[model samples]
Target: ATQGVEENIQEVVGHITEGVCRPLKVRIEQVIVAEPGAVLLYKISNLLKFYHHTISGIFGNSATTLLTTIEEMHLLSKKKYFFNSLSLHASKLMDKVELPPPDLGPSSALNQTLMLLREVLASHDSSVVPLDARQADFVQVLSCVLDPLLQMCTVSASNLGTADMATFMVNSLYMMKTTLALFEFTDRRLEMLQFQIEAHLDTLINEQASYVLTRTGLSYIYNTVQQHKPEQGPLANLPNLDSVALKAAMVQFDRYLSAPDNLLMPQLNFLLSATVK
Candidate 1:
């Protein structure tokens, strides 16, 4: 492979580049322009479907074939500028992601992604030893597949209107749980990438919460609570966290507090408690 792949196989590479990589690039571009939520999810669904079909064509449900291809791709990455370009394209897309929280649920897109991930991981157990070539393949596949998902979360978080944010966050949270649940099924070497996503999701939740709070204005809420004490409106009624924005913010704030993260600074916690009660 160092000398480059066989010229015959290089022709097959051209086929794959034409059929899969080109379509994937178009889908990634779709994601950039698509409206947030269901439309965005639809673009993601198409991208994963294209990827699943491409990989399945090459591997054909055979664990051995899957592993071999991974090794081949990794090696080809070094020798083939086409492979190099593909990897670079994937990495650039990943770099654009920031992170999110949402039930957006086993959405069609989410389901497809998990299905592909599970199929790959299920192809072999982490405990099984592979030759150096196979190990390289595993690394290549893991990086190529999961790296973009973390970024997907970022895109989802960034694009949503607050109205959809909390529910979406909840779904995203469960998606994280599903991702971690599959870790035991993959090679231990892949654990680091898996863990990075877990950590990134935690940060996503925090960022989502922060945005919600900022939108609702914690200082304003706190002052409002102070000036319009429930006691002042006793008997007839009580001052309430009645603003829809405040309620929405509370939902996200409570979510961050509950999800695993160090996002909530103590001062904000103090301000939140004072504002609510």
Candidate 2:
């Protein structure tokens, strides 16, 4: 009689636990499906983490069903948060056919994307995701969000002149690099962005040098020297390129130097980096 009563009591407790957990599971599912934005997802995950520990301690083995459900929802929210943010950014970046402006500033697409990234990073900043997991999270965010934005910026500048294109890309990339630098766990990304900025700066420098040489009427002599390598006889032996022409080019260059405002490409005036300018 005693053994039978004990088994009956256990069965009743199991049913009661199931009945309570059923409604909770439904509510959690509803919350996960109804919410939008990464911030809400992070909040939900944090809530679940609290409940996970509390329920584990209070109910012990009896709350296995509830614990498993909570864990599943936690993982689901994290996965959705990352992928949804990626989809949101990718779609918004190319929503229209906006082009790079005449002043070589950052394109409209880049500005919008940066705003979105700021929101996402703010949410990430306040999140309670564990330390061990953050590195992986940062890598995923970098690949999913930053990479596509950079690609879009590149594509948008394809039709511009060489100097204009480089200036636009540099402006767009510099803004992105600065934005990322405001947050932690972005060192690798910063280094990558720095490399791109340097490459474009090199292009801008070359373009500016060529423009200066052409404006001052020294390109012909410069091209001649390039074609006739040092392996050829002394530069004095080169035909039609001489000291008189060189002197005339130098005077033109000096005149422009005196009025330095007109020397650089008008487009380069909009370069974001002051040092580069």
Candidate 3:
């Protein structure tokens, strides 16, 4: 079973990178080649088909997959009936996981963001003809997917308890910074975009630090004081009233906050700012 699982994962990764990446590279090359307009159109169509197929494989029976497939083929009226059938499958999948709570960890959010980035990048890279327009559309779609994921990461960072959470939070922020840099490359006078990206990064850092200090560290202090003065009031019911946990949490928080700001943010910001001008 383990071997089978490993093989399945490898297959999935291979399908994504090859089915998606190679075609994109080829399409980019095609754009450089001075081909007939009809030939270029055919190539673009083929690239879109490959993208849809690869995405369909990944999503399996999920509702998102159906919607994605429909959007992918929407321009081709001949595929409308097929897309409708896929939409039905997606609706059925949605019924199973309706009203699922927001995913509250770095891994879940990060993985989703990465997958979306890969898909958008693949599509953008594979297109023939007007590069700038395709790039702009790609950037907009990426921003739409990333904004919510970033918000979720901020919320998750506050409640998490493990060192892994901190690492994941940092990684997610870095990914956002990288993506925003790509956007800024497309336009220089996008001051509003620059401000938004910077603000989001600042919020991410501040929220993470505050959560660590209050919930992780200060909770320990509150707990210790409560335990020592148990007879003082109803506050004794609070968890982590122990002095030991309080001290340890505080120490950990201090250690983390003392580190230099990760360099990736500043570098990405610079890149974006330069591109905009």
Candidate 4:
């Protein structure tokens, strides 16, 4: 029965991608290559649903077995070929076509797809099943890919002019943060990951650190920093600081730093402090 359900879901998704997404992509191509019109907003919406459902179905199974299977697959000599083929096929299907509307704006489809992919790919519960060396290595590789993308998404969200797009971007960042927190890793890797996340979020929120915070909730901190800093001499030469937010995020993260828990905070703090000096 489960197999039947999974197959049916896959069929529906295939139909949507072929019947709806393909035509929409062609229409979007015309819009991008020619004059502007209403880009296929309906198609974009349906495509999002199709991808979401497909990913969810695949991940609905046990996470531990899924992660194990992925590891086994990766260990195979042909793993690169499999990975590259999957990536290429997805790229070809999605294409780089833009929407016809000059301002339909950035679709959250990619971000959503990535989030679902991670969820489906992650182990079910690391607390119960301790990671072997091979699993640890796999985690590192996945982190390498995800970390930079998370930073880019955070920056993109901040720069998005429209309120709706900005909100979607922020939600995506939050989801990414929560997902990273769930993965089991060494203290150092976890700390580095957290720092990357907080640093980006801080840039979005800290007033003295980011001009982008001008209209954001974090602008208040920037205002406070500007008011308190000396106007000239040594203080003037020093960088603008939002000690409050920085301290808060660090303290919150410290709670997770412990033995057998991935000593990420102390190491990250050491590197960052060294760079500052």
- Residue 145 lDDT (model 4): 43
lDDT for each residue of candidate 4 in 1-277, tens digit (9 for 90 to 100): 9999978876665554445444544554444334221112212222333444454456443232333333333233123332333344334324442221223222354454455445433522322222464355446445544554544454445544443333334344445545556655534555664566455444333322333343233455546656664554443343443456556545544543332134222212212122221
Model 4, position 137, has a per-residue lDDT of 40
lDDT of 3 by residue, 1-277 (tens): 9999877876666555445554544554445243323223334544554555565566543324333443344334213332232233323332332221233223443555455455445545665425665555455444445555555565555554443344445455545555545532434323443555455456546545545556446744644564566565544355664456656776766765576243122222322234321
What tens-digit string does per-residue lDDT give for candidate 1 at 174-211? 45445546655344534564455346445545655555
Worst 10 residues of 2 by lDDT: 126-135
- Higher-TM-score candidate of 1 and 3: 1
TM-score of each: 0.34, 0.81, 0.33, 0.33
Residue pairs in steric clash, candidate 3?
A: 188-276, 188-277, 220-246, 223-241
Candidate 3's TM-score: 0.33
Total backbone clashes of model 1? 12
In angstroms, give how far residue 95 of model 2 lies from its true place.
Answer: 6.2
Top-scoring candidate (TM-score): 2
Residues 145-164, candidate 2, lDDT per residue (tens digit)? Answer: 78889878888888988988
Give me the runs in candidate 3 sitting further than 4 Å from their true place. Answer: 1-105, 160-169, 179-277
Q: What is the alpha-carbon lDDT of model 1 when measured against the actual structure?
A: 0.46
Tell me the deviation in Å of residue 210 in model 1.
12
